[model samples]
Target chain A: MKKWSLITLVGADQAGIVAQVTQILAADDCELGETSMVRMGGSFSMMLRVRHDDMDLGALLKGICESLNLHLHVDEDVASNCEETDPDVNITVYGADRSGIVAEVTAILADAGLNIIDLETAVAGTADKPIYIMTIEGQALQGVDALTEAAKKISKGIELNIVPIQTLRA
Target chain B: MTVLDILQYPDERLKQSSKTVEIFDQTLKDFVTDLEETRLAGPGAVGIAAPQVGCARRLVIVDVSQLKKPVDNHGYLLLINPEITKWQGMEKGREGCLSVPDYTGNVIRAESIRIRFQNIEGEWIEFDSGGYEARAIQHELDHLDGMLFLDRLVSRRSDLFTRKTYKK
Candidate 1:
């Protein structure tokens, strides 16, 4: 029976990382599924889902990671029966970089029963005066109006904009 | 009126550019009726295109009045060989398509537009539109050019999103 597993690799960004890693998987006849690889702040990270019958795949990947000085983790993929829900609204926050911005903003969302599906935050502007910007895609369980009201609770100086996502079937 | 079958994404036919509509005969008008039926049958669909229904012709239907929220719009437009003659400003908005039912994406569209097209009688008409109505028109027009919202994603990683299962 084929086994489903998730493989994660993280290390210093370098060329040929994908080629080297995929070559090992290809030799084992693993069927690749969804994969995401990105370079973040001088570090390269990869997450791959694969289906294979080979039980020794973990050892082979571990050997390769050790030789290349990269961190690797392989684990069995657990299937969840829960249906994935789409985000109903988008929330964007912009303010001077300060502590507790994300925590405070997320707390308000939680209070309104919003489930965050995707979030990306970045600090921009000058080194001395950084601006924090966070964009959140969330499932609004309590409707957009409730989410909007909850956003009002956020502290002053931080700008928050909530736009309901309109789904057009065209 | 017949409810036409909508062609899903990756069908290859959806990618083919549609030909311009030349004749404004009764057959063309009948097809428009079927296309509108297909649109109305969709869940909250505000617009539709001929290519989406396996007809590779430059025809589209847009009616933003169906939306619960009131917005500036031209009620029930039947546009043939539509073209965006002028446009200005840009805004990023989330968009979903009937062809690509599994995903939605953030797409940057013109905030306002000046467009020209023909009616069922082949009479040329031009007008300006903005807001959600403009976005809907742009989306349906893309079908004529074999373009999907996936082609204009704001960001591959951040902007593209999986759609939720449809209720009902």
Candidate 2:
């Protein structure tokens, strides 16, 4: 079996940050897998999975972090073996931008015994009068009716839509 | 005719490039019927391709009429040897494939398209489509070339999502 590592880096955004990090990993004989990078606020954060035959990855990655002046975290890849549940319900929420929308909505989901598989939130419109939109894909631990009932208890101002997602192979 | 089983990923056959329908005979028409049956049987499935059912032919069926809000659609479309002549406006939307069960991804496709294809009757047809209809057409068209939505993902890791469960 191939050994794997999950690596993350966070630091100030700069040009050539990805290129430098990838170059270092390539030089270390590590095969890169899936990578995700996003800029939040002003800082850039990246998460990627890698596989390697050598065991000196931790020390080598730490050295690269030092040279790049970025915070680094590495962990053995354990997620591949674990069973992951797919979300059965698709939830969309959109309304005025407010502080507690996510908290409230997530709380409802948690209370319903649902697991969030994928979520994306954005604030659009304008800063002064912004519109917040959140799309959540969640697995139902209980039932669709239970989830729907839980969503109904949320505050009235926000608009919410809960639909069962049909998974097809084509 | 009956609904054919949807071939899953790693089946090897799904990766094979489909050939254009050279002879539109009774066999081809029968296979197209089976393809339509399979598409209708699959829950919430709006379109299907020939390669998904172990047939490597340039054929696809798309019908957005059942959707809640199908925009700029031609109701039901049976495309053979479909080709996109012009595309406009890039948009990213979530899509899942019947062959790749338990996963969905954000695929960037043209927001609107001017496409040309032959109908089931073997006559050439051209039309314009936009929004969800266009997205569905593109998704099915990719199958004819041995491509899945996963291959067109905007960002592999971020755009790809594992489905957690099924309701219907």
Please provide TM-scores, in order, for all candidate models, with all chains considered together.
0.87, 0.64
Off by over 4 Å in 2: A82-85, A94-98, A122-133, A143-145, B1-22, B26-48, B51-56, B61-94, B98-103, B107-138, B145-147, B151-168
Model 1, span B71-120: residue lDDT tens: 78889999999999999877777788889886677788888999899999
TM-score of chain A, all candidates: 0.86, 0.82
Best by lDDT: 1
> Per-candidate RMSD vs. true structure?
4.8, 6.8
Number of clashing residue pairs in every model?
0, 12
lDDT of 1 at A139: 86
The window of 10 residues in a row where model 1 chain B has the poorest summed lDDT is B159-168
Which digits, one per residue and each the tens of the lDDT, describe model 2 over residues A32-151?
A: 876678877678899888887757666776876776688988888546542435566777788899899999988987898878887877778987999988888788789777888888
User: Which docking band does candidate 1 fall into?
Assistant: acceptable
TM-score of 2: 0.64
Best-matching candidate per TM-score: 1
